[model samples]
Target: MTTYFLDRGGRMTLPGNKFHLRVDGAGGRVAIDVTHRDHQGLSSGRRDRATVSRITQRTIIAAVPGDGAPVFRDGARVALFIESDDEHGSEPLTVEVVQQDVGATFRAELARLTPVGNRIELSVRAPDQLSPRALAAFRTAHELLGARTRPHAVADEIDIAIDTTASMAARLTDGSIPALADLIAGVSRAAGCDLRDVRLLGPLADSIAAEPLGTLADRVAAVVGETGVGIGRSTGVAESGNGDDVVLVVTDAPPVERLDTGPGVRHLVLSEEPIAADAPAQTGIVPAHLTATAVTAPTVPDQDAATLRHLVRGLLAALAARA
Candidate 1:
């Protein structure tokens, strides 16, 4: 009697072919279409008079179908497609059935489906595309801010403000800022969070707002010199709802003065330096190592402590002896 859970568009790989299970979501009113792989014809369940519980948020409870349960067996893989009332369709998420204990096998497999699971998958597939530091920063944020504050289905509307001050040129040149933005946007897509807009903060001027995240980096770089570090001013002017909105400011230097970024807005600062104590009590800083440049060598994955020590010693000695 092991239960499986999945949000909209979530994919899972499970064990076993012969199984009696109830698939449920959308208050048991959703269309459940199950297809077997390798030409195995699996029966699609019926909808008439099925006992369905209320669908709440992203949580899906199983619907008990009396004598209407579909039989799934003799297939190496099964594809489940669930469509809601709004007619939102997703590609079938295939579940590979392997010969193993269901409970034990699922426990190991489901551990990977953390809040930051998308970031983990991206790291494995394309490590070079983004910095490890950015990946680590976002993972930490998910733990501190996302996993705690955000709901599974209806997450808060998050806005991002990037510091484009003259001091940021080195980070801009190294592609650190761009990579950080990419990771933030990426995680939002992977995890069910809403990214409202990205703002470019410049000195003594208005913040430049951009959306559609596709051309964010190029757009920012084209006018990086014109932007300023008006942390206080930008924070003051940021339009946010009653604490339902989250403002994440990625900057090296945060203002010491208290900020008033509207009522009930949860503000967070990501930087290498600690935020000033005078800042608003609601504002907190999450330490992020964003100093890596584009030319920096990528850290080898799964290195033990000794290998890391050797690498660090070599880099330090080279730095100390540099001409």
Candidate 2:
């Protein structure tokens, strides 16, 4: 058996012997292409055709016929195979099976790291072993064929808005608070942004004695324990009119009537259950556009946590890309 490594646009030819194949990658998924051609020259008039009879994760079976007569089965392994034979059987007849490796493992790893619901901006460095053209194709696939997300500038700052209300207690207890804190750190590092400059915002009312907004910001700071600006009482934050600012609001269902502002806030509702549609507006918070993202609490299933993490990461990525 002959083993061939495929580049972005490489091709392979197969001998008539039966063959076996195996593919390994991070996601364990690969794309396969198969084509067949006919050889010239024959002794009696004959038309040649090849048929792929079976396909699986690791194997392919095909039948190649000569002169449109009896069919001969050819077994092949690997992701894809091509079959063809010489009409006259004089040119050392054989079939060509091409295998191209698209770096599914690398793509899967990237996907794992990518957050769901967010735009992804990819910066791919060519592997030393691969050519520039191959890398370019890989990048094209990532940008065009894969999930779509906007790309952001590497050095841009991301403003994170938090919702500090009685509702946040659930997130704090459910583990979403810490998980979100870690996510923020990862995003800050990946985007080359200054986590120190990150802004935290929440709701505040003179009626609340404990200053839940301030306390929430402190909790977020303690969870991240990183230097960043904390702003409570939404109206108190300096209005810079900076389009670069990203407002991430963490909240539970609050009545819209309670909200006193809505110009620059985006909502991240954390709960084991979905937020109600008529949930009250967070008081004194104005979001330019309110985008609702969900984070899973401890009460959520493990699978849901994974799903929510992926989604939140994607959302953050998208927000970062916008910057």
Candidate 3:
């Protein structure tokens, strides 16, 4: 397989079928033109059809068929366009042509790009908003989670807001909140965000606490109790973010007006209930126990913990999709 990386206005042509691809980068997207012409013998006429495909930084993979064929034939080429959102247009994607499925290959390549940092410091707010099971799970898996990575199109920073209301106390107690925090932080480093914070959005008030990832659970749990149940009134956080931030709010409560993060911030809600009408995107927090059958593994004895790890694997992918 041949791999090619194109900068702005770079062109490449396949040797056999005269499959030509021209790429242009600008404004956090890559624009590509694929042209195939018949140049053999009497068929030396230029097909001259200009097929343009625009790929945003969020989606780095796109394929254009050569010679209008389902499969690559002689003199036919397929183009895969990859681009990053950097200002200088750095990190151009690798385009390769192979006989197997390109989509599967792309997915495999993305999974290999882990985060840059292996350690993430712990920052928590309203420790009472966290739970025992979540805390335990986080502590057990903190190192593994902190070593994770995210996909392309990631923001510069990632912030997670956990709803500490009475209604969500059950979810918190089950270890979902802490698991979610680990999930986000694990991928933050790879997504180009070195800083990650978790804020406990309670009903009454908010507080700040910091510790190392391994011992954070004990600290968070001991501050309140064995559980995050009935912490207090449902209050929200007052964190300000800009366009370079990806703020993920984990809440079941629909409309907590005070939860307004800020304008120009890309917000994603991880909730089972319907969020505000203006919210850009929302993803449900799937109950791991209910889906235990789907999360089967021979080595993992702890089903809940295994399921939590499974969820962590998809956190960055989901964020990339929403982003």
Error of 2 at 161 (Å): 3.4
Choose the strongest candidate by TM-score.
1
Worst 10 residues of 3 by lDDT: 104-113
**Clash count (model 1, backbone only):** 4
lDDT for each residue of candidate 2 in 1-323, tens digit (9 for 90 to 100): 23333332333333222222222222232322122111111112221222332222122121112212121112211233223222334233222333323331111111001112322111111112322222222232232222333223322334445544444554444445434434444443333333333333444321111112213323554643332223334553423244444444445543354442433334555544544555432222111111121222324345544443454344444344222
Best-fitting candidate, measured by lDDT? 3
User: Which parts of model 1 have CA positions greater than 4 angstroms off?
Assistant: 1-155, 164-175, 203-215, 225-235, 263-288, 293-323
lDDT score at residue 312, model 2, on the 0-100 scale: 36
* Cα misplacement distance, residue 131 of candidate 2 (Å): 34
Give candidate 1's whole-model lDDT: 0.35
Residue 316 in candidate 1 has what lDDT? 19
TM-score for all models, in order of appearance: 0.42, 0.33, 0.41
Task: State the TM-score for model 3.
Answer: 0.41
Per-residue CA lDDT of model 3 for 219-309, tens digit only, reads 4444334435455544335344455455566666545454454532333444545445555444555644323422223233575666655
Task: Please list the C-alpha lDDT of all candidates, in the order they appear.
Answer: 0.35, 0.32, 0.37
Worst 10 residues of 1 by lDDT: 101-110
Residue 189 local lDDT, model 1: 32
What digit string (tens of lDDT, one per residue) describes model 1 on residues 1-323? Answer: 23334433344432321222223232122222222111121333443222211221122212222232221111212122222211123222222222211110000011111113211110001111323433333232333222232122223356666666665555546555555455555444333244666676555543444455555545555555445343234445444554444555655555556443554333444444655666542233323222231113333344332333232222111111101
Residue 196, model 3, lDDT: 50
